[model samples]
Target: MTAPETVVPTGKSGIYMPRRSLLMRIADMRAWLFLVVLIAFFEVWSRSAYGVSFILNTYNLQSISVFATAPLLLALGQTFVIISAGIDLSLGFVMGLASVIAAHVANYAALQLGLPPLAAMLVGMLTGIAMTIIPGLVNGWLIAHLKVPPFIGTLGMYGVARGAAYLFAGGMTISVSNSWYSTIGNGRVLGIPVLVILVAIACLIMHYLLSQTRFGQHTYAMGASQAAARRAGINVKKLTMKIYLLSGIMAGVAGVLYTGRFSAGAAQAGEPLLLDSIAAVVIGGASLFGGSGTILGTVAGALVIAVIQYGLVFINVEPFWQFIAVGTVIIISVLVDQTQRRFTGGRQVE
Candidate 1:
């Protein structure tokens, strides 16, 4: 939270230096704080109610990580889009489309073409991911070239992707017999899930992109003010396209992983995850208005949701309460953002 200080002239030959107060520093780490608080709450609840430890249990930790994988992948892309002051409502359905496509293509490659299981699985994954580029391009065209609003453009694509997924799936779940694919989804290395490791690598790449690259700087500039960015010679349109395309690719990866994990593909594979992805971005300290967020924060936000979902189930709470809990956290995150913005006179701290 230690930003470049602005010094003002004082009448008595002294400089007046302005610095972020302790509260502002605390606000910057709000996502992590929320995560810690939730974990502590769950641990205490488990200890008191069931005479068991939550965090100390290895199974609970693994379960939470498993629960977090898909949504975290979806949210990683979302963090970028939101930072660019845009949203991708189509990601959920896009993921479903990829899942169905992967299953179908994998089946064909194996059963019809007589490909090896591993080869078929790889083909299916590559093909499924490639198909997502179509929607990504269309979304980019609509929003960037045609000047369609992000919300309307993405929402329209959402329906299109969903319908296509169902049609391609023949309104039924397609099963995959490839053990290799399933292993990618479920197998672990050194006691960590493969999916978790994949997501961690993705997170690092995204974090570097957002924090250390020129593209990241341009994204923030555009989100803060497109007109100003244009004036500064930033290609807002191109950036917009890249942002949405990236979002689609992320969703596609999530979908492929979903199919691998379940050993089946359904049109509704990602239906419930859309909300969780958005919630993770918001709760991770990203501003809905634009121009502020971090991949690390999104990770914390995803973990927060995962902990809530898994912890509730462990405690035998009704599943329906998970939505309420997530919604409440989102609201608090937004309120905190607003309050912090007001205190900073509408300036976003890096």
Candidate 2:
């Protein structure tokens, strides 16, 4: 390897800085690059194989964005947990629980209690979001207070949540009759999906929380090193609780949005999204071992998955390939993360 030669200035020769190679500089943006590459590949494939433009179609773009919303929302919260060196497997079912609960509550409020449709929908949304706190607290207590491993604690909660969701739904889907609710779920604003617009707003808020606040700073500190963060006067336990709680809320939000989009709440609403959520976080450049990730990267990762899913169908690929494709990306991400860590001598880099 050749290092850049130092160039001394005509008047000042004391200062010379090493310039980073192009690869190193763009390492953080790998997710975006992957997304671009996938889009280009799919566009070419569609043109040649199907005699149509894949990415240029309005319907295809909208469908991809909508497909991404659920996973992206789930991944947003997962981003925080993973950044703190933890995971929350329960979030997927926590979303299911919220969905079922939201649909039931909305029905009762509107039909039984004689509340207005719009108000009932709002009530249901709030209650559904609030219901996730129970599981969040449980996972937090186990991991933060009892010293249980995050994976185990969250996995346990995952079963509990799954069971509860099915129980609430009575082993079936609950459809909402309210027209207002349906509109919220399926409606578009200025040619954009309401769900997509809502998720975009959520992404902005999460980005602020993760990148601009003291809490975010503390989260990074904890993920990088719990003991070191504690020694530096950061409260690791409280932060852990907050992280899981935030994660639960993220899942809950996704669930409510699910209800709106589908006009029905299924106990398994988020069952298949677990892998996609994790994949988005990983492909977005977050290390599985923790301590690094970004909201923007996660957005790109989710878009990459969505495009692959939608594009594959557009070009006549089997549905099962989506899983394989996403898993491959995840493996590559981990390998890249490990290599980057090695290059950095084990220091966490953003």
TM per prediction: 0.95, 0.93
Put down candidate 1 lDDT per residue, 132-212, tens digits, no spaces.
998888998899999998999999999999999999999999999898999998999999889889989999999998999
Error of 2 at 50 (Å): 2.3
Maximum-lDDT candidate: 1
Which residue runs does candidate 2 get wrong by more than 4 Å? 1-19, 348-350
- Error of model 1, residue 79, in angstroms: 0.8
Q: Give each model's whole-structure lDDT.
A: 0.91, 0.91
- How many steric clashes between backbone atoms does each model show? 0, 1
**Which one is best on TM-score?**
1
With candidate 1 superimposed using the best TM-score fit, by how many Å does residue 224's alpha carbon deviate from the native?
0.4
Candidate 2's residue-wise lDDT over 1-350, tens digit each? 98878755644766655555577557778899889999999999989887988888989988999999999999999999998999999989999999999999999999899999999999999999999999998899999999999999999999999999999999999999888888888888998988889999999999999999988888888888888999998888988999999999999999988998899988899999988899999999987767899999999999999998998888889989988998888888777877767665667554
Candidate 1: Cα lDDT at 231: 99
Give the Å error, residue 109, model 2.
Answer: 0.4
